[model samples]
Every structure is written in C-alpha cells, then in structure tokens.
Target chain A: MKYKDYYEILGVPRDADDDAIKKAYRKLAHKYHPDVSKDPAGEEKFKEIAEAYATLKDADKRAAYDRLGSHSPGQDFQPPPDWGTQYGEQDLRFEDIDLSDLLAGLAGGRQRGAGRRGTMAMPGEDYEVTARISLEDAYAGTLVDLNLSVPEYDANGRLHRVPRVFKARIPKGATHGQRLRLRGKGGKGFHGGRDGDLYLNIELVPHALFRPSGHDLYLDLPLAPWEAALGATVAVPTLAGTVHLKVPAGTAAGSKLRLSGRGLPTPHGKPGDLYAIAQIAVPPKLSEAERELFQKLAAGSTFDPRSHFNSEVKHGD
Target chain B: MATEPVEPAWLNDDARVSLDELAALSGLTDAALRELVDYGVLHPVDAAEAQWTFSARWVVVARTACRLRNDFELDLNALALTLSFLDRIRDLEAQLRSANAQLPRRHY
Candidate 1:
C-alpha cells in the first residue's frame, strides 16, 4: 500500500505544535468543505484533510504514524512486524486496508471487514451532478443516465473506485435549477455507515420555439396584419398536439394570449399556462394590388398611432 | 439490456426521517442535531414532542454541519451562523442560474 504523510497532507512541520495542526486543518477544511466549496475536487480533498486531522490530533495515532518511518508520499511499503502485532491486524495484507483505515484504527472507529480490531465507520459521500434535458423532454417525463466512480470494498476487503452508471427519471414539470435528491444513490458507505445520496441539478436545454419559465412556456405568435384586424382561428403547436387558438378581433401587437393548462405538466398539480405574445407580421415586399389597397386605406383613414405622444413631448424626426 | 428502475419516492416530500436515523446518517449526535433545530439551522417536517421528523434534504445539511463542527471544533452558535450563510449563498446561486437561462443567447 502507498504511504501517506499526515503532517504533509495537513501542511504542518514534523515538530509543529498541536495548535498549529488544528489551525492548518481549519483553514483547509473551510476551503474544501463540500458545503461552501465550489471546487470540483473539493470533496476528495476534504476527506483527505479530515483523515489527516483525525490521526494527528490524537497522541497515540501520531506516535504510530511517526513510527511508520519517513518515506516519500505514495511510496509502496509495508508496516514493520511489531506494528502488525501492536494493532492485532497481522493477518490482513497491506492491500486489504487503506492508510486512512490503518490510522483510523488509532482513532477508534471500526473499519468494515477488519474483524474486531478495525477503524472508523464513516458515512458515504454525496454526489451532485447536473442533468440537461431538452424542453420537450421536460414537458414529458424523461430518463437520464449519469456515470460516476464510487468507492466499494472488494472481496478481499480492499477499497477500489468502481465505475457505475445510474439512471434517473426527470419528472414532468421539472424546471431549471431544481435539485432532486435520491437517497442511497451516491457512493457506497464505508464499513456499516449509511450510503449517501445523489443530487441531480436539472437544467433545461434551450428550445427553438419555446421559452420556459418555471412550468410556464412563452412563444411568439406571429399574425398577419389582416389576421390581427379580423378574428381568425389559427393553428398553435403544443406538446400534446396542435390546437387552434382564436385571435380576438382588432388584437393589438404585444398582447399576451393565454392557452390555459397548455404548458408543462406538474407531478401533482395543474399544469402551467402558456402565453403567446402577439406580433404583427407585415409582408416585407407587398404586391402591386396589396400596395395600392394599403395606399387607399392610408388615404381614407384619419387614425394616428402617435396620438399618445403629447404635443409638449418632442418626437423623433 | 433492461433499464434500471428509479425510486422517485426519494425525491418526494413523503421521504421523511426520524431523529435517530438523521443522527446516525449524518454522524451527528442526537443532542447536536437538536442544537441545529434550536438555532433554526434546520426545520423539521414534524417537530412534535413525541418525535421530530426531518425532511430527507436535511440529512445533507446536518452532515455538512457535523463535518464543520469536528474539523473546526465550532460551537453551536458558530455552526448555525456559518450554515445560514451557506444557505443564502446556495439560494442566490440557484436564482442566478435560472435568471441566466432566461437571458438572450450571447453571440460571439
């Protein structure tokens, strides 16, 4: 097994006082603690820090660690003969235990499968991962697959990182930034400790036609000028199917038309409403007849769209 | 290959836990957990005299508290203050994420 230097992990000198070890531990813990840390590798670093602190803080464990002799970090070596007898762990091979478990023995927690004289029972690690589902999938329930490496004890009682694939369901009506916690879905527990949870952070992929806010959906409803002037039944697209929306007569631009219960589905409640913002779709190049008709209407009409602009308020030239 | 089935119940509000389960899972003592509730660091689903049940989400929060307590040797007051700040930071981060999603796509 590889040799780990606890003092080096905690960044303290060999003869450093107890208080110095503690202060160093606190600083590193604050920086790497999973709750406050934004670092991607924070959890693993924090665990190393905790294990180091656990061994060095106690006098007996520190003496045992010192007795293991000074070696370069990760150098492969075995404990001395007397060392095995002292902890009653003679039968287990070096491959069967971790350096953390060896020192955790001095800290007094039972390591799993180490028989009577074992180390600590630490809880499993919680994993947080992001799952990006398309807006269409968000409307209907969908499946997501995540790949993660979790710790596990082999048949010989050695810990190894096992790659695993987890499949989870993102329920309908799931919105961006929602956190879903799955119990016992994370890393395997150490010893007899409970398995940790898996947290899924949901992110909706951008859709070409729809904009989602929570469960609600927004889309631009383009209407021809004549269609806005005269009421018309227009085809509208929704997740389930296409439905006709009635455009009220004389509908103005920027009016939000509601399609009740036509948005994303919720797990347990009513689905959100969809809003279609009205946009006047004028023909970029009008035909000769169309231009003449528009010209005639302009000549016959006395309506002014700029009537709201008061005389005192300056208007752009 | 057959697809793995998911237990969606874990994500539901009904996935509540007792005080003992929370303590064992979080590596915090029963007394320490109560200190969290007393200081408003946590809000249990049911805070009755007969028993206190916390939402499953609190398990992670309690575990975070336990690690900070042991590593920093912090008293209850200090732990509570730090946790509250972390909570606010998490909320703000979530808000930022959603708000960013709504912004127009940047053309580069």
Candidate 2:
C-alpha cells in the first residue's frame, strides 16, 4: 500500500496538537466544502482534507498511524507482519487496503461494543453536475447520457467506484445558470432510506451567432451602408429557421429590430423575442470608382455626427 | 438492459409546496421553517394560509441552509443571514456572467 502522510495533507507538523489540526481542517473545510465552494476541484480537495483530519483528530487512530513510521507520500510500503496483531486486527490485509481504510477501520474498532445497531435509514447523497448545452438544445428538449463513477462498498467492504450511466432528459427552455432537479437520481439510499436527488445546473455555451439574455436572443446584424440608408428585407437566422426582417430606412447602428416570439420556446408562456442589433459594415479597400462616389457623397452630405460632441448639453432644434 | 431514461421536470419560478412537504424535503422541522419565513429567509406563496405554501425551489434553498448549518455548526439565528449572503453572492456572479455573455464570444 502507498503511504499517505496525513500531516502533509493538512500542512501540519506531525507533533501538532489537536487544536492546530482542527483549526487547519475547519479553515480548509470552509474554503473547499462542496456545497459552499465555487472551485472546480473543491470537492476533491475537501475529501482529502476531511480524510486527513479524520485520522489525525482521533487519539487512537493517530497513534496507530504514528507506529507505521514515516515514509514519503505515495511511497510503496507494507506494514510489519506483526502490525495487525499489535492493533488487535489480524484479519485485515494491509496490502489490499488504503491508508484511509486502515485508519477508518481502526476508528470503527474504537466504537465497537457500544450497542452498534444495524444500518439506519440514511438518505442518499445529492449529486450536482453542470451540464453545458448549446442554445439550440435549449430551444428543443434533449437527452444526455451521464456516465458517473459512483462510490460504493464492495462485497468485502472495500470502497470502490462503480461505473453507472443515467439517461437524463433535459426539458426545453432550460436557460443558462438554471438548476433542474431530477427526482431520485443520485446515489442509492442505504437500507430503506429515501433516495437522493440529482441537480443539473444548466450552462449554455456562448453561441457563435447569438447571445441569450433570459429567454431573449440577441445578435449583431451586419448591414451595408446603402442597405441601412434604403430599407430592405433581409433574411435572419433564428433557432428554428431563417425569417425575413424588414430594416427601416434611416436605421441607426446599435438600434434593435425586434422579431416577435422567435427566441426561445417556453412551456409556461409565449416565446421570447429575438433582437437584431444593426451594425453597419463598410468595405475595407475601396476601388477608385467607389472612392470617388464616396468622396462626392461626403462632400455633399450636411450630416454632422460630432455636432453634439462640441457642447456639454445639446440644444433642442 | 438499457439504462432507463429519466425525464426531469423543467424547473420554473412557479410550483407550490406545502409546509409539510418542504419540511420533509429540507430535513428541517416545521417550526424551524416557519421561523425562517418570519426572518424573510424564505417567502411563502400563501402567507395567510394555515399551512404556508412556498415555491418548490425553496426546498433546495432550505436544504442547502441545513447543510451549511450542520457543516459549520452555525446557530439557527445565524443560518438565515448566511443563506441570504450566499444567495446574494450567487446572484451577483450570475449577473456578471450574463452581462459578460452579452459580448460576442469569438472575435474575428
């Protein structure tokens, strides 16, 4: 079995008092606990921290661990043959067990002969998975197969992760940051306890062409200067398909053209609107003829875009 | 055998739960949930009803609060304040993310 230095995991000295170990555990627990932490690896980190503290906090378990002598973290080592007998646990084969397993068994040994009842009805643990989907999927309901390695005890009472696949049907209209609870979808309950739930926190991938705000979709529509100046019917893409949008003459850049009830479809109410924000596109390299025409239009035009920039407050004409 | 496909209910801002169900789901007593309602930590859909009915989402909130309370050994009085602050933080983070999403994801 590979040795895991409980002291190193908690960043404490081997001779550190219980108070120091507790302080370290509490501090790390507050930072990395799964429910409160936002860090991606917080749960894993908290598990290690919790396991380390679980051993070092107990007097008997800590002493048993101390007797194993020091070895580098993860170094392959086997306990002395007499080690099991010294701890009154001769049946446990150290080679097949983790350091955590050894320590945890010792903890259970300490609590033995205390009227330990059979398994109680404890609820299963809740599972939270962030499911990232596209804007198109949110428009239409889709199914996702979640392959999760769930921890469970083997026939020999050794902890192992059993692979399980669950098909989750995400309903339509799931927006970004939305949380959907799948009833009884988490870890199985112990004995006759109530099964836990699985929470799918929806994360919508940033769409290439569209930006979603709540149910509404926004996209920048590129329009040639002439098209903006002279009204035209242009085809715009929606989640379903393309639709013709009439851009009014004299439409300013950054102004929105609303496509009613074309955004996302919701079950509770009418669909949201799609907004096309106008953005005027100009040719980067102009031909000689185009340059001459542009120069003529600029020379003839009386529109002053910077007229308001000259005054602190504009006067109403 | 095929893994049974489970269809999840799309959660909305609506959906009511009575006090008894909320208490059972949250792993909290009815009186404690009522106390939370008094503190404005939770809002009931029907406050005047003999058994208050809350939005179903509050079950998650109350359970989260319970977890925090047990994990940190926080007192009941302090649980409401902590939950409110956490909710605000989550809201602010979500607001920031959506506001940032308003910009184009990829730039040419």
Which has the greatest TM-score?
Answer: 2
In model 2, the fraction of reference contacts reproduced equals 0.51
Tens digit of per-residue lDDT, candidate 1, span A62-154: 888888898999899888878867865556567745787656544354433333434466567777788889988888888888887666666
Highest lDDT scorer:
2
lDDT of 2 by residue, B1-108 (tens): 237878775545556778997886777888888888888889988788877787877877888877777667688789998888888997898677657645544331
Clashing pairs in 1: A109-A119, A109-A120, A110-A119, A111-A119
In angstroms, the error of model 2 at B30 is: 3.6
- Give the range of the ten consecutive residues with the poorest summed lDDT in model 1 chain A: A109-118
Q: Give the top-scoring candidate (DockQ).
A: 2
> Where does candidate 2 clash, by residue pair?
none
Native contacts kept, each candidate: 0.27, 0.51
Tell me the spans in candidate 1 whose CA falls farther than 4 Å from its real position.
Answer: A2-9, A66-87, A95-98, A105-107, A111-139, A146-148, A154-161, A169-264, A273-317, B1-4, B10-30, B44-60, B106-108
TM-score of chain A of 2: 0.83
